[model samples]
Target: MVPMPEQSPPSATHDVTNQPPPLAPYDASADAALLEGLRREGAGWAEDGVRLLGLRAGGTEAQEWGELANRHEPELRTHDRYGNRVDEVEFHPSWHHLMRTAVAEGLAGTPWAEDRPGAHVARTAGGLVWGHTEAGHGCPISMTYAAVPALRAQPDLAKVYEPLLTSREYEPGLRVPTEKRGLLAGMGMTEKQGGSDVRTNTTVATPTDEPGVYTLRGHKWFTSAPMCDVFLVLAQAPGGLSCFLVPRVLPDGTRNTFRIQRLKDKLGNRSNASSEPEFDRTVAWLVGPEGRGVKTIIEMVNCTRLDCVMSSATLMRKTLVEAGHHTRHRSAFGARLLDQPLMRNVLADLALESEAATTLTLRLAGAADRAVRGDEGERAFRRIATAVGKYWVTKRGPAFTAEALECLGGNG
Candidate 1:
């Protein structure tokens, strides 16, 4: 009789509740600060395209793409099964998807190609929106965008590569630059001994019989996006440190001497491949005046710094949005978390910081737009503002994200 006692079914203890819904399927362009800044920064005409990209970036598919891309980090293929040297970085399909979308939306080097007003501003706005999806892919995109001005230092090189760099097509693979529908760019400035002090680089560039052509010999400690079609490299020339354009594939369809020593084990940004590339007899073309590598690459550095500010702003905004959503739907102490005065204060503070970053970034974008239009005042402002913004905004990002994560308690 005791054995016949009915066993009680296991009581359910895993019911999901008090959790905010996924943040996708909402309009990322609906960001009040971003929209206001876009209009204020003279990119109002691009609002529609920005909104479209925002929607795409906020979709479930794009969210999944980001997750997958990060989860499956880029793999460096140093050699083929047949023992052939194939210094290629293989990425997940999702990575390619993100890249394709970014290129088609003109978030790479398109602004430099466009002759319209606010082109840079529009590109900046679009980049801010799309960058919210993922940060790693933005590396090559930013470099591609930055490479335009530096490449212009050598008009001959610019004439050959600029068109592809600005093309609204995502052509992945190492091929002759002219053969590709579009191209991406990367940069190699630092070495093992010299990091930010690029002037100390020891890579040697020996000029060939052909004018402007040189052979590079040395190792780059950090060269991100090695799979890119081209890279802006720094090396020691007869005239001193100088900048050179190194392509993965030479014009004759032969692989250049870009040996990927190994991929960097980074703390973050795993979706991008950062490598120590050994340049032994690597074919390169000199860019800018000899002995003026720093001056030649400064513009590219400024553009990348602006991108850093935008990236920081995007991070702050995304975290704040997550926190806000969680507080609105999550309840504790017999009321919605959003209703708590202390939580409200925290949210208000985060909102203020996020808005400030957004406003500052857009202002810099405006300055870039006007500066490119030959405004000396705007150019000067952009130079100073970009440096300050890069320093401040990027520094604030970790703290801002940490605080926003705290808002979600353990859920974060």
Candidate 2:
């Protein structure tokens, strides 16, 4: 038996070849399109910050953080060990780290707090840069950013929460609003039977003895960022469908009746938690004039739609970069893939698309900045352009990603 022992097979079959190196450690802000658009759109003051964020986002550490956060996803804790209803969604530590960086970098609602000329434009540039690292965590950040304008509908409520909401501190947990260094907000509009038709919502909000307060009783089908400190919810009030601010914890530090029925099993955005929450006797404060829930929440919606456009552009840019990097290093048919005419054409087309998206996104950010500064013409332009851009850019994302992925062959 010892004499019959055979030699091991050669290891050449396992050797790696023609593989593209990892795409990290590259400067994301080096994009000529983004930098040019930033200056042209009046956000040139933000170039330094955007470059810093771009460096961090493109580093290997941030890349690993994004991978780990998505891989771990979020876990729903509906109850404590003692059978107490906790209704908490626990995220991986990596998720928290990404969130901390985002908040510290003023990627959320900080623009509203700043008195600079191009604060919104700067914030938008920061978002576009940091968002390249991870997309899921941007949900809470965007909601917090959008919540400020809608919150302004009720001046007193805005006074109490706006500062905390716009603060750069990233405090997690359902603490009393006044006690937290900062706060994040979520939205609960789509109901089980209603979906986008919010007017069909059956959630009822009965007035409390205290003026401007009510108790909500209904279920939300898609309540994203369930762990946020507060939510802007739509419910049927005595007057009609109205908007209300629902805090997770009361001022006295008691948890609200935000029953997390279950976490959604989504096809993507796994790191962000979406839930079906039942608001049984959930205390809420009216946000605007009664029977004007749509009008009140539309401000938040418009802001989020702009973010959607930015997000779609981010995905396109990321995928295009990946494809270009892969083709440059990979070889096939006796030469480097990138030098091939067909592959070069594909990459050139993708680059054009990416540049267009980036330019349009930054232009819209400029419009938003002007609109906030009381430019009626800019406001009107944004109202139509945002919706159109969101539709076209987002709709083009899947196809663009698909084409870019095809360039990577099996590796993608």
Which candidate gets the maximum TM-score versus the true structure? Answer: 2
User: In candidate 2, what are the lDDT values of residues 1-412, reduced to their tens digit?
Assistant: 3586766678844877899889998877878888888888888988999999999998999988999999998999999999999999999999999999999999888999988777877887788778778899999999999999999999999999999989999999878988999999999999989887899999999999999999999999999999999999999999999999999999999999999999999999998999999999999999999999999999999999888988889889888888989999999999999999999999999999999998899989889999999999999999999999999999999999999999999888
- True lDDT of residue 399, candidate 2: 97
Assess every candidate by TM-score.
Answer: 0.97, 0.98
| Error of model 1, residue 147, in angstroms | 0.3
Candidate 1 lDDT by residue in tens digits, 289-338: 89999898887898999899998998898889889999999999999999
TM-score for candidate 2: 0.98
Predicted candidate 1: what Cα RMSD to the true structure? 1.7
**lDDT of model 2 at position 144:** 95
Error of 1 at 15 (Å): 2.1
